[model samples]
Target chain A: MSNFPPAGVFLVGALLLPLVPRRVRAVALLMPPVASLVLLWILEPGQTLTVPFLDFQLLLTRVDRLSLAFGYVFVIVTFLGGVYGLHLKDVGQQVAALLYSGSALGVVFAGDLFTLFVFWEVMAVASVYLIWARGTKRSRQAGYRYLFVHMAGGSLLLAGALIHYNATGSLLFEPMKGGLGATLILVSFAINAAIPPLHAWLPDAYPQGTVTGSVFLSAFTTKAAVYALARGFAGWEVLVWAGTAMAVYGVVYAVLENDIRGILAYHIVSQVGYMVAGVGLGTEVAINGTTAHAFTHILYKGLLFMGAGTVLYATGRSKLTELGGLWRALPLALGLYMVGAFSISGFPLFSGFVSKSMTVYAAEVDHRGLVVLLLNLASVGTFLHTGLKLPYFTWFGPSRPAAPQTRVPWNMYAGMGLAAAINIAIGLYPGLLYELLPFPVDYRPYTFAHVSETLQLLLFTGLGFWLLIKMLKGEPIITLDTDWFYRRPARLVYVIAVVYPSHLFATTERIALRLVQSLVSASRDPIAALNAATVTLFGRYPDGRMPRRRHNTGDYDPDRYRLPVGVMGLVILALFVALMLWILLAR
Target chain B: MKSTWLVLVVVTLVLTVSGDILTRKGEYGQWWYPVPGFFALLGLLGCMAIVVVSKLLGRYWLQRREDYYGDSGAGE
Candidate 1:
């Protein structure tokens, strides 16, 4: 484990993927994540593999409890993603997935800001290809938007990291005190965490990615941001409110969304809000809850995306309006998806129950009543959308008999089943997750009171869903989001500022060139040039006569100003001498 | 679907009743424990609020045609 960076396994696997035989590629893809997971468990906690980078010591592997926890889950999700993508024939997506997952792991274990920044950019560049590999015109455009947003985020992170280093004179990744640098760093992390109004990219791009690629996309990027926040800006009070707002904001948008993946993408914003709030609360249990939630969110969210992906793989549709009666065609997927749904809604005996409740509980203990209320409200909304509404409409709503049931790949089910099983296992035996948390486990999730209270909440939310079933029906319309502000205006601005100006300059240059050419040709014979200039300036010939036209009234013959070559030379030399004398006298 | 509904109702009844008997602990325990089906009411109202708020947003602000951003070539 000390021999090299753990992420190196995946990086090397990505490089070797193209050379491998097609028959063996799938198996080759699975090896790196497994190897990285093994390396994660074997590596000891502390900074290792330091190298001199300019004025700083680059700590490539910081094997602390927090990083290790993130590493464990990242490798697990990568393996699951590899299994889910086994059927894909696109080599570009395969390599991109490997690099993307590898870079996320690099961010997890990065000990210094510099190492983190490098991996941050690699994650952005690598993940955008996953969106592009969907190979749709819309996906191509969405990928560009995704890349631009992330590049902006990366620039902010770089700027913040440099300023932070300048202020502290150290590059070690640690908790930051309040200042412009810290605020900038926090804003950068907030962007990746998908806090509104910086959020729209996740919902914009994730749905546009390939099925398996969306699964990977959902797991890595924001979770890495949560890790960065937990490591760097824990206990910042502002995050508490921002995160609370995000929790409610995400579900509200998700409620109005028609696309299956769009709803889930927004819910990612909602779920991550729990972790951000926990980090902001800054209690031991809160941090513990944040880590636990991130770990479970990866599994359950990946499962949800996988479930939706399977639907997409089969029916070639992801909108709720087009999908129905999938429970019959994809019974296995329906059951597995419900597990994720229930888990995310914080139903009893599921991963979300054990993880998400801790954050709310921490807030209550801290006497942050408003935060508690907001988190609880968000939970109710979570159940309303993901747990009840999504499953209801996608699986059991109006039948679509015209749609063919395409065969889903076995590895897809295998991946989802594995994630579902883990979710249940962790939910039931939270100690399995608790021991991996950065802080000690003191809170219990399974008291009779908690169990009963949570059940009552979820069941009644189910009751609400049933009551509002008619109103909850999906429509074939899009709900404008913050992305609209950019999607429409940004294109207009780009055309005007960038595209139109360049085109205008090109046209102007062409006209200018033509005018210059005519001037140069006229200057070749100075007497004709002088005659034309005089005619244009004075509307008469140099001889005080109207310019004589040939057959066409406006056309003039060059013979009208024809002079001996010697006389033309003499005229040009005399003008030059007169200009030189004027310049000499003026000086 | 009927059986699922039946199971949900039964579960909700059992939990609400059992919650009445269970000893509550920690912050807000007094307020929450004394109120029968407190979380249930909260969940119900919360879900309703979400639907109402989202519907209002959709109707007034957020909703748009399927081609609201225009065709795929619009931005291009």
Candidate 2:
């Protein structure tokens, strides 16, 4: 029942997840929550235990309200995602999910940044295999990009940890004053949260992952970063802008995407924006908003992805262009997905409206008028894309001729139904959500003004969408985003500037080698020499010039030796190399 | 092209003006920046206006094919 034992149990379960016999993988899936239940029930708040390391004692777990709240949600998500992924059949993916989710759980409960970073990097390395599990060339490329981005984040996190340790001479994960160390840690966490410029990977990788794999991917990384941000940099104030930037950025990009999964992927970042801005405000209300939003976000986002995943599995299509008119056949899935979409758009009587408004409410109380206003606009934008575009394009648009209406498995429906029910349950009753909040809860959500305003914001946004559709007649297509800056023209520049030159240099080297071989062969051939003599020495007399040039042995005369074309080519090559080296030396 | 840029410039100006107005309250003819909230509002309004107008203008410029570059899985 000790903290070390729980860690050991979870670690062992993760290690054994893939090694188990294929027939029993489903049974093995239940191991994670059991370990979680043990940890949760055994470790009381304020309980501390240490494992002896070389010169210091490593605190295995420090149970607190913040850590406990995150731990509880992660455990629940693991169970739900596992149930959704039951049909995955890929043992490697199952094990990776377990280990990756377990490591994230370890991070929140960790007493220090060192423990957090260890699990942080583990989650990064373990999760990429999920992307690779798709077994396509695109998936491979996405996996590689995913690896580089997360590894860069890990390095930044390590650097921040070292800087913080040096500054405070302690590794405890607590609030730090603004400095290079703090900024490094914050930026590092933001990258994982999929902040702009670095955010392309979220959509790129998540959509390419296996149908079930995306469910797990959606919940962990951003939420873990939120936990870290809450732990280390709460009330720092800069997060408000960062969070706001991300929220809007996500909505714009989501509006532009055609892939259903990609649309959901962008919304993940958008929803997290509210949390980041809330935490940045750093009041009791703000922090509570962040935690509450995180809890609700995990459920609704997972539900959305699961719905998209079901479509992908049943139809073998995910792009909006190839889908429509499934509302009749997959009514259960479509209905569940709509709950998720409504919750995300912050509609009245849904989870998003309750949780998202809390952040805006906090901003208003702090007299943060601008934050409140922008967040409201983002709420409207969320309504436009997720609320309207996602469900409309997928289930109600112009129908594809042969779209499938196959029934999804029972467990998948069970998982989505469970999450959607909770989403609605929380929306109708904020008290349940409030009790789970890490901080003391005093905020109310059922006021008449709040309800009316939320309805107005969402309805007006829907009206704008209708107006745009009527006036401009915009067709649904995959609009390019920040990825274009890196994927297209910039990628072209990289190829020309880097790959093209290297390829050219390689070709030139091959040509030079061929030219040298031709020269060496020509020097050894008498007939070739005579032919060369006619062209180079005499210009018109071949027989007479060769007779006059005949030496004692087979052709050792330097005068008879006219430079072959191949030799001239080699000379040109040498000159070019020398010039290149000279230029390099000069520089 | 010219009209799109003009629209973008106008939106940027509107956003900047709104940002300034919100950041500064009419407090005895004195003006100051209202730090994080001001920038957050700027970002939000900028994103929304960009979405609405872009959708309007994208109708003119952004042409996409039903299956322009079908899933070729750009690879070796």
Tens-digit lDDT string for candidate 2 (A263-282): 78988888889999988899
As a whole number from 0 to 100, the lDDT of residue A154 in candidate 2 is 89
What are the RMSD figures for all models against the true structure?
A: 9.0, 15.3
- Classified by CAPRI criteria, candidate 1 counts as medium
lDDT tens digits, residue span B1-76, model 1: 9999888797766768566556555556434546666777888888898998899989998898887776533332
Question: Mind listing the fnat for each candidate?
Answer: 0.68, 0.10
For each candidate, the DockQ is 0.53, 0.07
Error of 1 at A568 (Å): 26
Report per-candidate TM-score of chain A alone: 0.91, 0.84
User: Model 1, range A7-29, lDDT digits (tens) per residue?
Assistant: 78889999999999987787789
Clashing pairs in 2: none
DockQ of candidate 2 (2 decimals)? 0.07
- Top-scoring candidate (TM-score): 1
TM-score chain B for all models.
Answer: 0.59, 0.35
Which pairs in model 1 have colliding backbones?
A: none
Interface RMSD of each: 2.9, 9.3
lDDT of each candidate versus the true structure: 0.87, 0.76
